[model samples]
Target chain A: MTRARALLIVPLAVFVGIVVLLYSGFGLGRADLHPSALIDKPFPDFELPTLAGEPPRRSRDDLVGEVRLVNVWATWCPTCAAEHDELARITGETGIGIVGVNYKDDPNAARAWLAERGDPYLFHIIDARGDLGVDLGVYGAPETFIVDAAGVIRFKQVGAVTADTWRDSMAPVVASLQAAAP
Target chain B: MTGRTVLGITALCIAATLASAASLVDAYDFDNPALEARYRTLIAELRCPKCLNVNIAGSDAPIASDLRRAVRRMLEEGRSDQEILAHLQDRYGDFILYNPPLSPATVLLWATPAILVLVGLLVLRRLGSRRDAVELTEDERARLDALGAEDP
Candidate 1:
């Protein structure tokens, strides 16, 4: 091909390449959504009220010494409800610690919701003001973060942690994190 | 009748806007005008992590609300603008910053438009040059005329 013809193909090729790249970019974005800004960092310090009575508070300090999932959920969120059984199963099968953040939810409503459908969390923390949610960079309800033994946030699952998500992403990360825990 | 209904709806919308505007008033008091200016700029520049490409100031998402409060608290505590921006950016990733810093990750983002312009100019220049096609050889012209004569 002549130099001019070859040069003409370059822009066309770049345009096509960009189109393909954008298509994949959108696909990946939809899959991950808002990846929580707190991955690979220490879990944000928060002293939130517990969902259950008596203890009244749960903090990041309560999550150290083992790999655990810090799940953000609310009574208002249907996705959290959808993922509840999966979370229960993870807790039941793996016996791993899952700390639930009852994000911006009514205390009474949150208590009732968990009571109605078995509370899977080791300890459910109340984020009634959503202060912890913002500090944790929580996009929305049903986000799960895997914090290692030292309180460092290792991985973040942006959406509902379904059986598929647990099997595919969180399980593998959990395995490594568990191994890495001191 | 339709016009009256439209006017009523417009009035209702204006009322709702005013009510929400009143609700959005910040609770924090700035130490100085410079601090207030910095706070405003920071909120405007920071993306609401929970909203669809909206700044924290405009977004009503719970995260946005809390972020606004956090910014105010930081400003009140005498944290520098850079410190507050870095703190939020570190937690929310570079996506939090509306005007992202020029860095390795954003080199393509900053360069794509410029590259496209250069490519466009190259194409235009090539096209302009091509318009002045090379002169056909006398022998070639004679052959073309002969072929035309036979075809006719």
Candidate 2:
């Protein structure tokens, strides 16, 4: 009887183990948080119009000179609005440059949004048709990529950049890339 | 209506429905039948990055549509299936492929089913041998023989 009970316990333990593993997997925050394929890869070449409309166009060459955050945003994305202040704060506090990609948004609406809510970006790349966004493997808006001085993408944050995300996750990456810059 | 006429009408309705559904999913025209077939196969194989579990062929998301367009463009450009898939994989990573390539990270994912089967077989073999090893004691054998004699 004791041996039979022990054998039963083996199956029960296995069941419990699988449940724990699955539970932990689900608890790891957003299900969409998969690793970006562009990590350590050179930023995809693009020559898109800037949000200001004065320079008319900017290319990958302009972004290569500094360690910066390439943030994908659109006026339609509420999460981008939510993180707008945090982005401004990041640049103010860390002195890091941010380049925006106005992904798939109306240029007028994007410019109006920036005017109302204080633009933190050094310059905004107009990805009006999401051509550059597709090249960057962007599935959604408000995704942020940390690009090194040499134009390599070091890391990517899929969702909004909250204060906690900035302090804990993105700040360290940016700092390390800055430290390693030639 | 006559039964024959009704049957013909029903068959026509079914064909029309199927043709509409096919056009909805695959709106792009291909001059070559082989290229069209390849397009179908590729879309079915590629997962929609924006949607959960749905392949690009089944997903109605904008990104899925964009990817489908890319596939069509590449197919028309005379690019091989491998080159087209590699292009997307380069951008979207292994997640876009329903059938993940075998790599060090994915070896366990591909191997787990076989491992489980092997372990199950080993456990079954051990249990079978244990049952086979169970022999009757001398007293039990004597009782069995007595019962057998009485039965005869």
Clash pairs for candidate 1? none
Error of 2 at A32 (Å): 7.3
**Candidate 1 chain B superposition, TM-score:** 0.67
Docking band of candidate 2: acceptable
| Structure candidate 2, residue pairs in collision | none
The CAPRI category of model 1 is: acceptable
Candidate 1 C-alpha lDDT tens digits along A101-147: 88888989988887899887889888878777778877677788888
Q: Which ranges in model 1 have alpha carbons more than 4 Å from their true place?
A: A1-28, A31-36, B1-28, B120-152
Tens-place lDDT digits, model 2, residues A1-182: 79878888898899999999998987676534357578888999999999998799999998999999999999999999999999999999989999999998999999999999998889998987777877888889889999999999998989999999888988999889888888
Question: All candidates' lDDT scores?
Answer: 0.83, 0.90
> Top model by TM-score, which number?
2
Weakest ten-residue segment in model 2 chain B by summed lDDT: B18-27
**Tens digit of per-residue lDDT, candidate 1, span B3-44:** 999999999999999889657646567769998888888889
**Chain A TM per candidate, in order of listing:** 0.83, 0.86
